[model samples]
Target: MREAYHDQLDSIFDDLAGICRRVETAVSLATHALMNGDAAVAERVISGDVEIDVAREQVEETAFDLLTLQQPVATDLRTIVAALRMVSELERMGDLSVHVAKVARLRVPDVAVPDEIRPTIERMAAVAEDMVGRVCEVIISRDVEAAIALGRDDEEMDGLRRRSFAELLSDDWTHGVEAAVDVALLGRYYERIADHAVSIANRVIFVVTGHHPAALAEQ
Candidate 1:
């Protein structure tokens, strides 16, 4: 019985890792669609967001079932509880990617990003995608050190956002108000995705150590 119960907990962990992979793919696809203003690709990303939502719901159901049926204690209980929180963050990351794709669709034939800040936007997207991939590794391996490293990746994302905003508000800015808005919103979307990755990493640390990484960082 103990072996079977442990296997169930491992299954939940595996499912969470799968959820992370799906969100990572979503962000990459959304970035490609945004760069090219491909309405078709954007539409696909928007519709595909439902898969992430469905996966999150399944993870929640399984975690809750474990809590009720097995009464997991200590690390096992933390694992289930942390899975709930991590999946919520992963779902939000998918939603942010959908928002980016929506901007691509809304702009239609023209790309949402202007030529002036294209590099900055691309940097943000790259940083965000990289962080999500790393977070997936951290979760799957239960690597506390890699989990802590997400903070640095998130900082790089923040820097990219700052550069994007500076360009938007610069005296030479000539992309027009609508383009500026799209750029601003896209930057926020990318930044938020990285933020959520960091949050998941923190949760992974919590599951392993029984203490949130955020508190440890402060000490």
Candidate 2:
């Protein structure tokens, strides 16, 4: 019976990793749609989000069952609890991807990002993609070092966001206010996606170390 319970715990972690893979695909497709103004691909991303949501719910239900039926303690409890949090983060990342797709869809044939700001947006999307990919590895491997390295990626994302703002505020700006707003929102969406990746990494750290990264930093 104890072995079965441990199996359930492993299943929950596996499901979490699965969700991360889904989010990674969503981010990549969303970026593709944004870069090329591909409304069909953007629509694909928007509709596919439901699957991620459903997977999240399933993981939550399974984790809840483990928590209640098995009454896990120590590392087992931490792992189950962390799975819950990580699933939520993965869902939110999917939502952010949908938001990017929506922006792409809204602009139709016209790209939402202006050429001047396209490089920045592209870099942000690349960083966000890299982070999500790393997150999948972190969830599956529980590599604390890899998880911690995600913080550096998050920092790079923040810098890209600031760069986007700088472009909007530059004296040569001529994209008009509407394009400016779209660029700003896109930057924010990508930045938030990276932030969620870091959050998931920290949760993994907690599961392994039994302490939050912030607390660990204070030591």
lDDT of each: 0.90, 0.91
TM-score of each: 0.96, 0.97
Q: lDDT tens string, model 2, 1-219?
A: 999998888888899999999999999999999999999999999999999999999999999999899888999988888888889889999999999999999998999888988889999999999999999999999999999999988878888999999999899899899999989998989988988888888889999888899833522
> Which segments of candidate 2 are over 4 A away from where they belong?
215-219
lDDT (Cα, tens digit) per residue for candidate 1, span 1-219: 889988888888899889999999999999999999898889988999999999999999998988999998888988888889889989999999999999999988999898989999998999999999999898889998998888877778878888998999999899899999999999989988988888888888888888877634632
Locate the minimum summed-lDDT window of 10 residues in model 1.
210-219
Q: Top model by lDDT, which number?
A: 2
lDDT of 1 at 142: 92
